[model samples]
Target: MSWARIMAPLSGGEGDATALAAAVRLAEPFGAEVAGVYTPADVADVMPWMGEGFLGGVQTTALESLKEAAAAGEAKAREAMSHVTYGKNAFVSLQTPVWSGLSAESRLSDVIVFNGDSARGRGPLAEAFQQMVADEQRPVLVARGEFSVGGPIAVAWDGGKEASRAARLALPLLEKASRVVILAAPKASSRTFDPTRLQAYYAARGVTAEIDILPDSGDAAPLLLYAAGKVGAEILVAGAFGHPRLQEFIFGGTTRSLLAAEAPTLFLSH
Candidate 1:
């Protein structure tokens, strides 16, 4: 498996630069195209609030304001993308139906990239991040501080479908890592499984991986994080387990803990 294209959603905010830089780093090794997509606010979404009885002048002014905001955002996104000179790059500006445009772009790409702000639900692209992982079910890379693709990588295994999917989707990346380690805590969960299954799977794909059976702990996130740090892993591959609950996405305990942590880039799939 190979990654041919990477999609990075840019909100023209503080996280845009980090997210774009991470995408470029991931793309360089695979010779993949890095698409910096500018996500703009859809004017149509606000039109309903104007009410049917609103005056024409008021509506026109509101529309103009929205257009101006979008233009400024697009300019900022372009500026952020301009710094990427390492690999193939493209600048994409979403249309009126911004969400649909983003979804389409994500479907066509191999993986989606987001910054720490988006991953922590603290920025303009937070909702977009949730939608991609939960609704779109696409592979996503949450780029944290100083993300590097040349370092060691750790894979969290739970013998679940989600983990299996994540491992499969992350094959291309794992194949390129300096070292790959599989971290599993079978005694922590009710499910009985072996981590060597994953090791064999990776071996079949020509990737050598070491297995680490963590001590039984009530919570698996801490163990996984500790092991990843011990191994000096630059990235942790795991399945994002979450479902939409009304307005928010409720993530599984381990997934939540990992997302809330401050270090190690996350490569996740739902």
Candidate 2:
């Protein structure tokens, strides 16, 4: 069976379990392997204070908090894993303590799922999640209020490389969708990208897609969302873009905006 793993950052919080449970439910149909990812918190106290005597005490506290975060993360992971009883293919593995700046645990997984709670807070967990989607080339699905899976799927297209990548990556789910709406936001300046090319690509892939030219709105994300709701799309697919210089530090406005919107979305970055 085709497998897609659901990975979420484990910071002791309210909806961590809910996010994992939602992933488990989404994975059930594919008999997918569901895994929980833990990236331990970095204690700010690790950096030494001005005086020499203060170093030892600060280091000790930092080490203890790191231990506590790890222990807490592992405990939560175990609890979430136990709740997943759907299939034998599923398992949870805790990541060993690694230094900061390493790649995200979700980079290797098929699809990464993020809980929507992060949108409101000033927490690093949410910040890390935003960076992961914008920086990583992998597809990510952000879960909203409740775990609702399997509904109409919508594709937002500008006939760019990124948009094409999103369509290709989401084809498996798109095939199962009751209806697939391809919302194109074509602009006048782009002569190379045209309707025929976009339609042919989907047709060759055996997707019976219906195309609609998105209205000239100030923003494309909401415009696409509007079309999605019109067709009753539960999942949104689109290409993501980022500023070249701060690409690692910040996600593009469109990707950040969509994730902030808390719609179940799959994004591909160029």
Top candidate, metric lDDT: 1
Error of 1 at 258 (Å): 1.0
The true-versus-predicted C-alpha distance at residue 210 of model 2, in Å, is: 0.6
* Residue-by-residue lDDT tens digits, candidate 2, 1-270: 155665656555556676676677667667667766655565443444433555577667867777787787767766766676667434443444332332545666777666676533345366556566555666666666443455677887776677778778777677666777788766521434665576677778776778878766556667777777788777788876633526623744555567557565444444
- Can you give the lDDT of residue 40 in candidate 2? 56
Quality of model 1 by C-alpha lDDT? 0.89
lDDT (0-100) at residue 69 of candidate 2? 73
Q: 97-169, model 1: which lDDT tens digit per residue?
A: 9999999999999999998878888878989998998889999999988867767999998888778899999
Candidate 2 is scored at a TM of 0.81
**Model 1 ranges with Cα > 4 A deviation:** 53-59, 242-252
Error of 2 at 75 (Å): 1.3
Q: Where does model 2 exceed 4 Å of error?
A: 43-55, 89-104, 119-124, 145-150, 188-192, 245-252, 264-270
The candidate that achieves the highest TM-score relative to the unseen native structure: 1
